[model samples]
Target: MTELLSDQRIDEALQGLPEWRRVGDAIERSAELASFPQAIEVVNRVAERAEAANHHPDIDIRWRTVTFRLSTHSHGGITEKDIALAGEIDDVITDV
Candidate 1:
């Protein structure tokens, strides 16, 4: 089984992810795009990366804003996978 990350490690990892914050056992970030279609495009891009990594995040969309919450459900907490995917998601947000 994948091990859950320790609080210290998660904190350190989050240092580089300014837009993301710890929320209980998961980390979350929300991005606002110029239009609803652009927000959906970001979601679609994130979906591709998540599928490639075999990890997924819970997503919520509200018009031009999208919120992503990631956790390693199998481990019941955050893991390196979540951190890595967050970075990938950041990249997608930046690209779009």
Candidate 2:
């Protein structure tokens, strides 16, 4: 199992991910797409990536806004996996 990230490490990771913020034991980011469909499209793309990474995030969709919350539940806190997936989510956003 992956180890949980330290607060210092989590802060460091968020430095590069301006869109994502540390929220308690998890990190979250919200994106506003062009339209509702566009938002769903991004979610679909994120879903694919999440599947590929085998690290699924909690997704909340409301109209054109989609929020993703990442946490390694099994590990009991945030971890490198969540950070890596956050980076991937950012990439997906720009690619969409």
Candidate 3:
């Protein structure tokens, strides 16, 4: 299993991911997509990645926006997995 990241490590990772923010013990970002279908597609991509990593984010999808909040529930805090997943999501949506 992937190990949870330390607080310091989480801080360092968030530096390059400006859209993501620390909220309580999780990292969060809200994405405004072009349409609801596009948002669902984004969610699908994220789901594939999460399944592969065995880590998942709490996702909320609206009409044209998707919000992702990630945390290591087992560890009761943010972790490297959350950062990695967030980065992956950001990359996937960069050209969308």
- Number of backbone collisions per candidate: 0, 0, 0
Q: Name the better of 1 and 3 by lDDT.
A: 1
TM-scores of the models, in the given order? 0.98, 0.97, 0.91
* Clash count in backbone of candidate 2: 0
Writing each residue's lDDT as its tens digit, candidate 2 over 1-96 gives 589888999999999999999889999999999999999999999999999999999999999999999999988899999999999999999988
- lDDT for residue 92 in candidate 2, whole number 0-100: 91
Better of 1 and 2 by lDDT: 1
Model 1, position 42, has a per-residue lDDT of 98
Two-way TM-score contest, 1 vs 3, winner: 1
How do these models rank on TM-score, best leading? 1, 2, 3
For model 3 the TM-score comes to 0.91
**Local error of candidate 1 at 56, Å?**
0.6
Error of 1 at 40 (Å): 0.4
| Higher-TM-score candidate of 2 and 3 | 2
Q: Which candidate leads the pack in lDDT? A: 1
Report the C-alpha lDDT of model 3 over 1-96, residue by residue, as the tens digit: 567777788788999899999999999999999899999999999899899999999999889899999999998888778888999999878857
* lDDT (Cα, 0-100) at 5 in candidate 3: 75
lDDT of prediction 2: 0.95
Q: Cα lDDT of all candidates, in order?
A: 0.97, 0.95, 0.90
